[model samples]
Target: MQIRVADKAIDLSEGATCASVLAEGLSKKQFKNTVAAKCGETIFDLDRLIPAGCDELVPVFADTPEGLDVIRHSAAHIMAEAVKTLFPEAQVTIGPAIENGFYYDFAYKRPFTPEDLEAIEAEMERIVGRDHSFTCRLVSKDEALSLFKDMGEEYKLEIINDLGQDNYSLYSQGNFTDLCRGPHIPRTGMLKAVKLLSVAGAYWRGDEKNPMLQRIYGTAFANPKDLKTYLHRIEEAKKRDHRRLGTQLDLFSFSEEAGPGMVIWHPKGMLVRTILEDFERKEHLKRGYQIVQGPLILKRELWERSGHYENYRENMYFTEIDEQAYGIKPMNCLSHMLIYRSNIRSYRDLPQRYFELGMVHRHEKSGVLHGLSRVRAFTQDDAHIICRPDQLLEEITGVIQFVKDVAGLFGFDFELELSTRPEKSIGSDDDWERATTALTDALESVGLPYEINAGDGAFYGPKIDIKLRDALDRKWQCATVQCDFTLPERFDLHYIGQDGERHRPVMLHRVILGSVERFLGILIEHTGGAFPTWLAPTQVRILTVTDAQNDFAEACHKTLQGVGLRVEADTRNEKLGYKVREAQVEKIPYMLVIGDKEVADNVVNVRLRTGENLGTKTIDEVVDMIRNDCLEPFKRGGMSYSFF
Candidate 1:
């Protein structure tokens, strides 16, 4: 057989393994760093035999993303082996590599504790030290079932039965064997840097009704340096956890009495939300969007007509009112459609952009409910545009630009992903194709790069998802623009064209900040709770150095508030240092120190949150400085704002 590695071709026997081929073809260093090999699009384990009719072998290096995934997967298998060795009664179900890590689920007698995790880590280290090579074998379904059945792995048995395949691949290292289609590293000794992070209870396959299993989360890297960097990021993420910051900053709370996934916004938190909503309203109005409102619940028939009943009902909340079934909306597009249908639009009005800070509800499982990011009830900065077919591309491009502007305003850099149709989606294949193409065309037109996220679009149409990168370099899905031809067709929406005939219009479902709650959560972490002045719930705090300066502090607060600044005065009988520290802890942008010098001079001493003193400034100068700081972001985003 003829095969190629890099630019060289060689004749080899049919049963040559990838490892032997690489050892012959690649340099010593390249062979040492190679964890696996890629034949065309398919990755193969080093021990796996090279398939016939294949010609090229591309090395998968240890530091590459794919190679890391292979490493993590191998680590998961090794971890599973350690668990089985340490706890013979444990029944392993499945383990898979995820982004940045891997996890294994085990049906055990009880939940694993932290102490157990330590022991398991030790066992895994011992297993790695033994340097056992991983080998694969093929078995028929019945034989696989019988083998696992004899081993008393009920989970494996169930998996094998459900697989419904004539043959299955089994990977084994040392005494541990698992059903896996794998391209694992050659040996357990390849796992040099691994850490078990946490243990949590997970349902067998994420179904709440299934038997719960203990899931161990761990991550592996090519070496210890990368592992240390990842661990540092993990620690930083913990410090910036939104839930902890929410409580510390008096932002929002979740209460069991109020039911799960419901955000109870405290005064400060609500103020921040209001600021965001108000800004959204102003921006949309400036961009030719008409602000609109929709009811909290619509009749079930409306949802049915929109295909939500058939495709999205599982995630929707439904109720009955006056013998009529209603669905509390999980999306804002339906009502926006109704609004567009209420008017008879002409081609002259090619696009009608309707904006709403609409509150939506989705039935999120209790286990998936997160702080503010994933909640049952949240508001979306939703807008739907009804445009003639000819205007579709331009409208999509405009929305993408709007997203870029908004992200820039928040000091965010984002990447775009074009999501295609899902299996349960509405619309014809041609419509889906056109919609997907339009999104891609818009991205290309603007010279913006995006990835294709297949089978992850809305049921009605394909979409462009904008994921914002935060300060910690974490990505958050906050913006999206979805193109929908199905909804307009389903609702019979039309606009009079130049030909004086009714023509079907295209609809766009979009959100700049997907869920206000989720965006705020991301913003909190992104800013580390140090919000910019314009968006901060409290922009400034006037601190009285002494009781004698209390009156002046109140005057300064009034002056700031008169200029539309969110200001507060700290006049308690506390030390000045304590007040400053408290204000800084609250993440306020500016702290005005009102002491005898400032009170006598009719000026305020300015202290920034970063501990920089700006000398003494008159009330007018202070106001101007604060306003400039507030408008700086708008300028960066190519927008104008006024503080007066």
Candidate 2:
């Protein structure tokens, strides 16, 4: 029998199974470069042989993301096996791979303690040392159900019953069996370095109404050293958690009475937010974006027209007024579309960009909300660019550039990802193809590398998502540029072309700092609450050694404030050391100490938050240093600086 595996043809014996073919290919180094394998249209374990007569086989590699996911999935199963061996009664519900790692849900009576995790880790090491082979078996649905039932595993039986097939598959290792559609690793040893990270309470199948399950989150790596490094990074990330730093630096707070996931920005937090929003507003204006405002609540019909009702209704809030239904807007595109249709447009007005610091409400599940990263109500720096078919590529290019400029200002290095059509989307096939091509061409023109995320785009369009690598090497998606060929059509948006014919305007939906609150949260974590000199809420604090220098400190503070710096004088009845420590704790970028000698010399002693102390320097010189620091990413007023 002949088969094609990743565009290569191979011959196999009539009785060969999928596992045998995979083993043969790997021995010949045909699959060394591959991450996973597929038989016909079904994804299969690499250890499985191609059923002889199968005409197609595709090998998947870890370089592609799906291949990595397969590896993570296998790691999850390994972790589960370790858990069950150690606890014995820890009923495993389901374990699946997520974005960065994998999580296993267990119907345990109590949370797994820290000591329990250590025991599980030791057991997992033992299991991996044994290198038990994972044997796959295909059984009749009745047989599979009977097997799980006899074992008193209700969850496994429930899952098997829901599977709509007469013959189902199971993978067994020793006494452990799992009901899975799997492309798992061949042996336990394949998952070499493993760590069970944490435990949390999660509802079964993510339904809040279902039984709560204890979830164990973990990650795995091909190399043991890589696994160690990943664990170190996780520790580093926790130390820099924004919610913790927010309080340590007196930045923000969340009131229980106010509700979870809502942030109340303190004076310092608000100050930083103001600077960020002001910067964004100016950039938008310079880029020919006309600012617009819309009501928070609109008639429900508007959302229905934008396809949000059908696709995103579950995540939205709805209300009824005067016997008419309304919804608090979850996005600004629908409102902007209505604004655009309020008047007629011509070819000369082809690309109209409307910007808004729009506030949107989303009904986020409480369990999923974490600090400001996931929130219920937030503001988006949203913009919609309406253009003709000929202008689609150019509009996308401009939006990408806009995103880059804004991100660079905050010292974030970002990568691009193209999200394609989702399973349940609104547009026609042709529109999806056209919009995807436009986004691809735009990214290519910029010479930026991108990865495609199949079935992850918005309902109305395909999008180019920008993921920023944070200070701790973690990635966060913060910018989006989506091309919508559907919304304009739904709203009947048009522009008179040069040929005097009506044509639908292609809508480009874009956002920089996707949500102000979330971006601020990232910023807090990235900087560890010590923002750059320019963006710091309080750029400098003037500390005086004694009453004799109080007047001088106040004058110096006024001088710095006059130079457009956020400065305050510490004139309280406190020792100089106390004031200096206070300033450092507050994360003020710079601290200026005024002593009698310095006051008389017209100089100031500068102390950095990182404990760098400089001898007294002239006030002008000190101001010059700050100006240079402020110009790090952009040359403002002919001043510049670099990351070094």
Candidate 3:
């Protein structure tokens, strides 16, 4: 048999495996780090025999990202072995590698506690020390069922029977065996840098109807330094959890009486939401977008026509309205399309952009809902652009620039992804290709690097998704620009072309700050509740040292408010240190320390929440300092500070 490794052809024995070929071609150091092999687009175990006439083989090393994923997946299996060793009654069902880590699901009588996790981790270390080889074998379905049945693994047996395949792959190490589609590491000894993160209860296969199973989440890295860095980031993430910060900052709350996914916006939280909404409206107007609003519910027939009832019915909330069925909208596109069709448009009026901070509803499952990130009801900074086909790439470019500018406003770095057409999409093949090419061209035009997400686009169109990196270097999905060819066709949308003939228009759906509520949650954690002076719900606090300085503090507060600053007077009957401590806890950006000296000098003593003391300054100087902070990102781009 002939095969290719790194574009070099070599002849091997008919039954020779990829491992054997690599051993002949690669240096010992290179072969030592290799964990898997890829033939074209398919990845297989290194021990798998090379197919006849196989071309273009590549090695997957442990030091690479994909290699780390493979290591983590095998680590998950090793963790399963450790669990089964310590608690022999546990039955493993499925385990797979995900982003940054892996998890295994098992059927157990009770939840695994912290102590159980510790013991299981110790057993995993012992197993790794044994350095057993992970040998794979192909077995018949009946054999797999019987093997699991004999071991009392009802979950595994059920999974094998449900598969209904003639053969299944079983990977075994020492005395432990698991059914998996694996390209695992060669040996248990390769899993040196592994950590068990947490154990949570998940329904079998994520279906609540199925029995609950225990899931252990863990992560693995190629080296100890990387593992240490990851652990340090985890600790930082814990300290910056939005839920805890939301309460400590008195921003938002989730009430037991109000529902799990519903958010109760306190005064401070409402202020933050209002500022963000106003900013979005101003930004849309700056970009020549017409603001529009749509009803919360639309007739079910309209939803069915838009393919929502078919492709998205599960996430929608339906209600009967006087013998007619209507669904609460999960997206704002359908309404925007209706607005475009409300009147006739020509090529001169083709690029009609509609903007709305529209509220949407989705029936999110209880388990997936977190503090504001996933919610049953939330508002999107949504917009739609209707333009001629020639203007498609330009419109997409405009959206990409909009996302870049907004991400810059919050000091966030972002990565872009082009999501291609999915298997069950609604558009024609030509339309899908055109839409995808337009998105790809726009990304290239902007000269930003992006990866493709195959079969992960919206049913109506291809999209460019922007994932933002926060202060903790965690990614949050907050912006997307989708180029739709199906919706306009389905809705029969058309405009008069240059030749005065009716032609179909391309529609674009986009959101800069994807969801208003969710974006606020991210901002809270990103800034740790200490937002910039401009976006701070309360920009400044006037803290008086004693009753003697009360009059000066009140006058100072009034002056600050007169100049358009969101200033508050902390005139509580308390000591100066106490007031400062409280302000620090609330994460207020600037504190005006009003003392006898300040009153006598008729100047403000400023102290930053970050512990920087800016000595006394005149009223005009203080105002200029704050006004500059208020217009930071906008100032850089020559954007108007008119909204503030």
Best-fitting candidate, measured by lDDT? 1
- Find the number of clashing residue pairs for candidate 2: 12
Query: Which digits, one per residue and each the tens of the lDDT, describe model 3 over residues 1-644?
Result: 46677656777876888898887767799889899888777777888888555766688888898798889989999999999999999999899998889999988889999999999999999999999999999999989989999999998887888889999999999899999889899889988699999999888877777888999999999888989999998988887788999899888899879988888999988988888888888889989899999999999999999999999999999999899999999999999999999999999997999999999999887767889899998999999999998998888999988888888888899999999988877879999999998998889999999999999999899999999999988899999999998999999999988898999999999999998989988988888778877788888999988888888888888888998899999888898899999998888888999888898899988998988999999888888888888887787766666633
Compared to the true structure, candidate 3 yields what TM-score?
0.96
- lDDT per residue, candidate 1, 323-408, as tens digits? 99999999888888888888898899869999999999999877667899899999999999999878888999999999999899
Question: C-alpha displacement of 393 in model 3, angstroms?
Answer: 1.6
Cα misplacement distance, residue 119 of candidate 2 (Å)? 2.2
The 0-to-1 C-alpha lDDT of every candidate, in the order given, reads: 0.91, 0.83, 0.89
Residue 193's lDDT within candidate 1 is: 97
Model 3: how far is 562 from its true place, Å? 1.1
Query: In lDDT terms, how accurate is model 1?
Result: 0.91
Please rank every candidate by lDDT, starting with the best.
Answer: 1, 3, 2
lDDT of the structure predicted as candidate 3 = 0.89
